[model samples]
Target: MERKSQIPRKTHILVISQYFYPETFRINDMASEWVKRGYKVTVLTGIPNYPMGKFFEGYGYRSRRKERWNGMEIIRIPLIPRGNSSVGMVANYLSFAVSGFIWKAMTDIRADLVFTFEVSPMTQALIGCWYKKKYHVPHYLYVTDLWPENVESVTGIHSKAVIYPIQKMVDYVYKNCDRIFTCSQSFIEPISQRGISKARIEFWPQYAEDFYRPVKKEDSLEKPKDEVLNLVFAGSVGYAQGLGILVEAAKILKSENRRVCFHIIGDGRYLPKLQESIKANNLEDSFNLIPRKPAEEIPKYLAWADALLITLSKSDVFSITIPAKTQSCMACGKPILVSADGEVQEIIREADAGLCSDAEDVCGFVDNIKSFMELSTDRRNELASNALHYSETHFNKERLLGRLDEIFKIGA
Candidate 1:
């Protein structure tokens, strides 16, 4: 008698995110990594309109709707472009959620599990919930932003009338999801307060991409040929970033005749206001506002700097956030200059990676910058070494991805 062997089935994962590849998010790398690990991955995302508030050159509502990238399938749905206005942004989010429902009705894609990479608006998780209901699969939510709080922070709307409904929506999503993963440990209590059990929520911090590594200064094309102490801040320049403090700090540094230059890279809604502040203060020479560059090119800019700058606005929601850039900066082996609060400041202190100041503290931030400028070359090197070592031990990409794999297997 011959015995027949049973073959294992491939786990198909459906990822629901409003942003995806070509949008400069870590989810792109995660999806690719999953594909490399032999999981069948399909991404359901909207047209690529993000920090720029417009669609990418080649992507649109009517074109490039379905594509393949890095061995995974990408299905883009039609949504309103995110123009530079509050109404436009709201419309953009609603359009995606509405379109997602329509797409699910017409499509027959089935998956073993549903995963959502939630950043803002948080409404995208509804799509994953719908899929879970239809396919009887577990839905995992990776929450990068806390809703109702995030909405209040981004917009100035504090009315309970509006926030109550948003809070209800958030509660529904959290309740429906099988498991929830948060980027910061502080988020656990908040999620639990929403009637979710602590056991259902886990803290799964983000890891840096492989490309984010130490680059020799001499090899970096972006390196400035000067003796000035270069401090580089790379990421979105939104109001939540609290970059306005840099302008005031630059004025103080310039008055003291310090050879320090603040280099801010990236673009957002608040860029024009920041530029105007620089021009108004006549500190343009001390502050360099470079245009946004690709994520792959960020290491080169980091290598050019003596320290990496990280900041967030003074808000309860932001205080708990460990910005994704924190991992990126630590991975690059650069000394960090933090003007944020809570989790990020704690991480910097724990790693001894660099200096920290409370959010929007111009004097404290300036003092930290000056102190770094006064440090000996050996001390600077020590900070850099500490950063890289901490990243390897705490946020190694391989280890985190392996944990993710285990999570999926358990859920499946």
Candidate 2:
């Protein structure tokens, strides 16, 4: 008698992130990585509009378009473009909400799992709940931001009238998802208070193993050999990043070191202000502001620096936050100067991966810079070695995604 063998099923995983590559945001790297692991990845994302707030060039507000990149199916829907304005942000979120739902309805593929990325408002999670109800699929809600709390903190909008419903919406998101992920530790208590089981929540920390990697200098960052010292700050220059302090520190270090220069990369709202401060302080040559380079280009900028600097504002949203750049810099084999406090403090201190100062301690930061340059190659190499080893062991994207696979059975 011949026995029949059962064939394994291919996992068709649907990831709902409003911002994806080509569109340009956080999840693109995640999405691209998922595609490598053999999961049938379908992204339910909006039209290309992000940091620019206008539709990304070459992508219009089309009804639907399926793009195939490296065996992954990217389904893009029309979303209202948004920028740094209140009205624009609403239109952007609503556009994706309405269009994503419409596209989801039209598609026949019932996903094995849905992964949602959190952003400005909590409403995005509601859309995931809708798909779960509509298709009987489980979802993992990923929180990059804590919604109304962060929005209110950043925008200066505080009123119970506005806060209640938004808080309720956040609660709804926590209640509905099968699994929850947050970028900040501050969210743990607040989310647990909502009665969601702690076992269901996980933290991704701030990481990107792909874009951030250790590379030899000269061949990578294309930086001219420095005579005195060079410091680099990569990633978005938003208000939350508190980049101006780095500028101030550079200003103070100006007279001390002739060759000391701060290379600030990436762009954001605070960029112009940071630039103005540099000019106002007559730091045109000492403080250079460059555009945001592609993820691959980050290592170049990082390798160019003698040390990496990562910081965030003292906002409640930031206390729990670990800037993704920290992980990126660690992977780049450069010792870091971390400025945020709390969980971020513990990570760097425990790993001996980088140096840390108070969020606004310009002098302490300066002292670290002085110390970093004076350290022998052996000491610097030790920090670089620890950072690389730690990133490889804990922050491996494939390993993280593999964990997600077990939790959600993504590619099983």
lDDT of each: 0.91, 0.75
Per-residue lDDT for 1-412 in model 2, tens only?
Answer: 9999997776777888787777446677777667777667888777766665677667875534678775778878777777877788878877777876776677677888888887665676777887887888887898877777687877788998878888887788788799898877677776788888888888766566565777777566556445857778887788888887877777778877546778888877677788788889988878767787887778977776777788887777777766766678778877777877677777777778778887777888787777777889888778878888877776777677767767765321
How many residue pairs collide in each prediction?
0, 2
Residue 64 lDDT (model 1) = 96
RMSD of each: 1.5, 2.7
- Tens digit of lDDT per residue, candidate 1, span 44-100? 999998988999998886789999999999999999988889999999999999999
User: What's model 1's TM-score?
Assistant: 0.97
Best by lDDT: 1
State TM-scores per candidate.
Answer: 0.97, 0.91
Q: Report the error of model 2 at residue 138, Å.
A: 0.4
The TM-score leader among the candidates is: 1
The Cα RMSD of model 2 versus the native structure comes to 2.7
